[model samples]
Target: MSERTDPRVVVLTVLLQLAQEARQADTLDAFAFVAANSLKRLVPFRNAALWTDRPARSGVSAVSGVAEIDPDSPAMIWLDALCRHLAEDTSTTGPMGVRPENIPPELEPQWTEWGGPFALWLPLRHPSRQVVLGGVWIIRDTAFNGAELALLERLGEALGETLSRHLRIGTTRSAILAALTRRRLAIAAAIFLLALFPVRLSVTAPAEIAARDPMVLAAPRDGVVARFFVQPNQMVKAGDKLFELDDVDVRNRHELAIRDLAIARTDHKRANQAAFADPQSSAELSILANRIERAQAEEIYSRELLARSEVVAEKNGLVIFTDPADWLGKPVKTGERIALLSDPEKVEVLAWLASTDAIVLRSGAAVRMFLNTAPLSPLKASLESASYEAQMSPAGVLSYRLKASLAEDEPPPRIGLHGSARVYADNVPLIAWILRKPLATLRQLVGL
Candidate 1:
């Protein structure tokens, strides 16, 4: 045989080569796999496993000669339990030989079924910090000598340094992944429970305080509005002068009719006197009488028009209209709406609900109106009726007209006060309520 090389030199050569290989590993998992399988080059072993203490409990991360690990497998499960039990023993800080008698009674059967006659536990620790990062298990039929154990310890330290370097590079990511893995089940359970929580399905819409079953005041004459006796939102009593039309045309007609009546009466009086003297004059009296009757009818009609020129409130209520400037000198047609006489105490909530947000509202769905003037104090109301068809609202949006009655116990709001309203429908799951709008939009886009 050729001259034998010194065993010390051989061991040193192998240790250096393994250290270089560990350093070259690109990831922590790669380094762990190399550490578990490559130790056989210096110390012979039939099987090997690597366990990490990164998590709360130690877990077997890699197995020698196995490309993928099935965590549920009996062997892996047993090994994981064994690693967790062994990690709890703080006294075993260094390489220790594990024998059949060394294992606890609870794990004795599993150890006997899967372990070899001799097993060596090599704790991987930071060289400078001396903190345990992980461990390696070597199983074989024969006992591990002192020299081999010493070499394995050096190898463990080298591998641990390499692992720590990779860990430091991805410390944030590793910590996040470890935490997520540990609490994944709890997080999933919490989310599932939250999705099933019951919530009231509701929608928001623009609202206004409106008159409920109030009298509408329309223009009674085809003439220019000369003056307004009552301002917008002014309280007025029955027979109060609300507005007046320009009386110039009606007064002119009245004067003409009065003059014509005077002329016809004068002519009639002369014919009646002449009829007693001349028979032919009596025929003229009949014609003159007819002319007087026609003039009387014209005078009466003009007098009625003069009376209608002045508008009056029919009932005692608040008068709601636009700015007085908009109506002054503005000519209006007969029967055209000009103002509203509303009872302030009998007010209602008028909401313009968007068609997209419409739901199956019950007869008495709850409605909360947040008025612009007093948003802090919302007015409670109950839905009374909703329009069957959507119409253009005053703001020019297509919306459904919803009328709700304000709570009788609460004082009614002033007419025409604007606000926002929240209309609540039937109860549904929280997930459904959250996803309602998104799903509606998706359906519209997809035309499904």
Candidate 2:
């Protein structure tokens, strides 16, 4: 009633018996160690490599009948391609065997150089043959015969079920809990220490680097900008000609005023001579003197207008704005903003703290700034002032203005550079730190 067994058949039967001991897989190492070592005894191969399909833990490999296997070696590449093809293309009719010349052109050169064995790619599929859990690759000097391939394929179904147990995420939860039980005291102590820890609470907001003392440069008169002596961000000293206006109209008025003043003086002198000749002409003499005085005032006013056309810088600083094209040939009314001159040495940070996050902020709080351009190195600072009321930000949100002074030892940031700011508040319990904002809002909302 029973079939007789050959030595090879007896070895395979023993190998299958040893592998079936895996009741429910818990780890890849235990399952792989049993299967790979047992397969090496039954199969006539120089090496065997087994791997999983998951990306997170795929790098580790278990080998049998060989001292080592390099991941970068040609054998590994061929194994990778075989597994991928087996998993992706189910159209392959049945278990396939590869001879030496059957390898792809790209992989042939590397395979020949290694002088390795003829590799076999075996797919371990589910019992129903619906899914593949993983794969096995064995190597030998010659191509495996049909009877040997059939035996390997028959063993794949049982191996797939056992391997799938280890691939599951929840299968090891009971094992993890049991291990944690042995160290329960240590874990409990760590949780207790973390709860009692007091830490400073901090809030981050949008911020910008601004000049401490910014001077407003404006149009001196209602005229077009003729020329700019310096470009934007150029350093200028007091009395430096910043720009010139169209002075043709003012120059013409000055010339007319000068000619009128000379004529008025001559008339006044002739009237004085006539007044001495006749007493009745004294009234005419008074009128001519008044005309001469009026002409003198007109001439002075015209001269002032000509001087005002050429605007000059009043302080030493850098002019901040766009290029020359924005100013040149642009008509501006008197007192219209031209640009801002900022002192490079005197600079401060202006942070827009959102109203929701500004409740915890106080004067003299520790502040840290990271300019967008230099994000790695944060600039140390201290809060100087905060607005009593909220104002609309450029981004259309109501926020409070906060001023901060940079550290004395640190170099000043460039004016108008925008970045982020973090303000550290008072220390509190870990629980309070998490619930601080929500509690404040609750009190304000319902007076709780």
Candidate 3:
């Protein structure tokens, strides 16, 4: 017989052609159509359906000779259930004939109505994983013979490999579309622009209102403080008594000086009276006169000490000091600060910038002071000076001393009012401004 007339040659040619069509199909939907309708060329089937394990698409994807699939339809629903039941049989890996007697009792009733006298189940498996990806269901009026089942088994592998490839490509394409959506792209652009935007480089430090060029009042001598003549923040005039030291010792010294001076004068008078009569007495008069002069000097010095026991203000201004009780009976050394005489209107901001937060600043960089008492009313100032080297602050931190002059138009806050200062330097990119501290810490840790 001629090759064209040979039945075996015809079957082999159709199988090869179907396999090529499956591989050449551009999409999963197209391949599903081919799998459901085109398989009849090798084995005749009255109806055919395709099913998959994908959760979002777990149902009959296509039906023989139907361009569109209505999943809600009774036939489609029943077919989906039947395919799922058949796919669970792990023991039947090859093409097998299915009949009512072979299926569970629950599916027997539906088989009589929806299925034909014989059905063929072909499971699609992943080429490498050997896991079931899905299956194809075919029903016909005639029973499938052993030769037909064997031919279908080979075709099942080709279909399974093609279906698996399409599923993987679909998943990758879905992921790419999801990640490149317009909303996500817009958000990324916004963040990138924000990082590049310019902002004034700034830092916050501890600050307070301080007197400008105020006169400091310290202890005049080494003594215990007896009393304070003026209260803290009280306005005072020049020569007003500010405070006093213990004067008991000074008063006693003055009294003794006076007594010694009196004795010296008496001795000098006696020597002068005797000097008029004898030469020896004349020599004694010179020595006695010198003694009188020395005694007079001592008396004058003691009187001055007594007068200075009470300290007075040198200028007319406000007296700024701590609680009066703190200084009462408190011992002080010479030149130790006791109080400050400051003008109420003249004030400046004193900020302690930590060494870690220090930045390059000019003479007139902007500074804003937010007081603890009145934070809403921030006082504006311009940097006047910064210490050349860092020093230990009262809070036990090494920091640079910064002095900023308050704006002329703004009223100065009360002296000694504590606050925070925000100092602004040259403009820089927002990203650099935000990462400045973290980058500095990283550099310190890595030594790079």
Best prediction by lDDT: 3
Q: How do the residues 183-276 of candidate 1 rate in per-residue lDDT, one tens digit apiece?
A: 9978988899999999999999999999999888888879999999998999999999999999999999999999999999999999899889
The runs of at least 3 residues in candidate 2 whose Cα sits more than 4 Å from the true structure, single-residue gaps closed, are: 1-197, 237-239, 277-280, 314-316, 436-448
In terms of lDDT, model 1 sits at 0.86
Q: Which scores better on TM-score, 1 or 2?
A: 1
What TM-score quantifies how close candidate 3 is to the native fold? 0.64
- Candidate 2 collision pairs: none
For candidate 3, write residues 302-412 as lDDT tens digits.
898788788898889999999999989998898999999999999999999999899998999999999999899898999999999999987999999999999998887
TM-score of each: 0.59, 0.52, 0.64
Cα lDDT of all candidates, in order? 0.86, 0.76, 0.88
Measured over all alpha carbons after superposition, the RMSD of each candidate to the real structure, in angstroms, is 14.5, 16.1, 11.7
Model 2 agreement with the true structure over 1-448: per-residue lDDT tens digits:
9977798768678557756754344677767766666676556787676766763645325677544568776566666665565556454424556545765566556665543667776676544454555677666788788877767776665676677667662335445655777579778887777766798989899999988869888888888888888888889999898888889988999999999999999988877888877787778888888998999999999999898998787888988877889878888999998888889988988999888887567788899999999999999999999989999988888999899999998899888899999999888778777787889899889977
Models sorted by TM-score, best on top: 3, 1, 2
> Can you give the lDDT of residue 331 in candidate 1?
88
In terms of lDDT, the poorest run of 10 residues in model 3 is 169-178
